[model samples]
Target: MTPHEIGTTFYAYTAASSSVAHILDASKPATFSMVNAHKRLAILIHGFTSSHEDSHLQSIKTNMLHHSNGEVGTVIVVDWRHGASALALPPYLRAASNTQVVGHQVAHLVEELRKHHGVNPHNVYIVGHSLGAQSAGFAGRYALSTFHWKLGRITALDAAAPSFENHPGTFLTKNDAVFVDAIHTSASKDHNPLNGVFGFVHAFAHLDFYPNDGHNQPKCHNPLEIACHHEAALLYYDASLSAHNSCKFYGFSCHDWATFHAHHCTKHDAEMGYFADKIHASGVRFLATTEKYPFCH
Candidate 1:
């Protein structure tokens, strides 16, 4: 389908979900008031076969607002399900190809967020998962080249491995934002065949994290459980946003899991995931997680 036919839509939510119920019309200054435009805004984009209503994105959306208290003003979920639905034949590839078009739509939406609503580029954060993460990269590229505006942050949760390995232009990268970070849950360096990699193997962001050594997670032992392991990144990130969460989301900056496991690279200052305290972070890090939910333990 063409980019225009994709009919990408944006839904905004505040602390009180029922209060402000207008679709984001960037042209209208009044639309800004509905979402308390002055505070920090987050835009979430889901991966293939998912929509704004999907639990994958909604969990984070629901948690962020509840956990952050009133600190975060608005959470916008981008609905490009028309381009990401299962009905699209050749499923994965079709959704993958549409990422570029959806990215263009996001780029325009992001530009309007500032121009019409008086929101600064620095106050915005774009978070995406899998194919959606790659699309977020495209948005960052378009925003920079077209508008010369740099976004504050972009968090890529396990960017899709297929269709984006060797193509720098089609995947999430550090250049996409001032602070671009990614979590690798189902893929690791070298991506050995026996490991069953699903997430993109490359460290494509400023802070690339390898949880559970970036291989199959605790319960995702079955080789064919691609979807299970891939969603681990999303699960870990959402848990980090919990208001009562302790400081258990930390990792050591190391060369690889070997270095971290061997008891070297002992410094574990920066908390990984949603509230990663260290912003000037560079290079990959390693951390351990449990086999079950509330994985931070």
Candidate 2:
């Protein structure tokens, strides 16, 4: 659909939803523990085959709030029903309907939030990890086309670079997201063509390549890890926190990690601990009240 058309739909959706007194109540903080009353809204998109608890999502949410002062704003963690078999999908079909559907769902959700709580579209930002990055890209594009949604930023952390490679320019309009930024990690051992293609895009505002060899860092092969950070997702996010605040874009990889070996989750936890602390210091703005992890002070 044309971008203008999409924007109209988004506006109508938000307005209709707002008229319901219970809509805001339905979106209560209990719905998303970290969400607060006054702060702006930030949506968290999980990587492919991953959940909100994934390290990358956790790290980004932690970091953004860290930089914003314990008040990181509202985080809406998106979860899709795509089966775990996405790993097995012939690369071609993976980007087809799945990408469009998820993007639409997120857009719809944003409208609901905007109308219900008077959230400013310009203040809304989406931080996506892995496949979630692709979701952020599509959502941003949809919003841009509709014109009703203007964002502070859409940060794609090592976004799913492969699935969108061959799609027509319709998916990516020129300068579509002026405020959009991306970060990619070269340290990842995954050799997928899509990943390579995704890395080539000039859309990335900032790119950080990690060392190819490091102690304790594992290869980017585990499906769960690949699903989350096969190329060490959280670690990549940790390295990209210091840049300016315009719709962050970051990528990461570790040194000497193979695309076959396995690593433990604690290894990820350690990385997150450091990132969480750094975000708290970076001045990213967040909503008060502890949810998953206390906003590092």
Q: Model 2, range 1-297, lDDT digits (tens) per residue?
A: 232222211111111222211222223423332235366566776655555545555555555555555444555556553421255456335533355656765666666556665666666766666566666667767766764665556665555545464465523322434345444443233445433322323334322222222111334443444232233434445434533343232112222234312321112211121123232122111111111122111
Q: What's the lDDT for all of these models?
A: 0.79, 0.43
**Deviation (Å) of 61 in candidate 1:** 0.4
Worst 10 residues of 2 by lDDT: 283-292
Angstrom error of the Cα, residue 224, model 1: value is: 5.1
What does candidate 2 score on TM?
A: 0.56
Write down the worst ten-residue block by lDDT for model 1: 188-197
TM-score of each: 0.91, 0.56
How does residue 62 of candidate 2 score in lDDT? 53
Which residue segments of model 1 deviate by more than 4 Å?
18-22, 27-29, 188-196, 222-224, 277-279
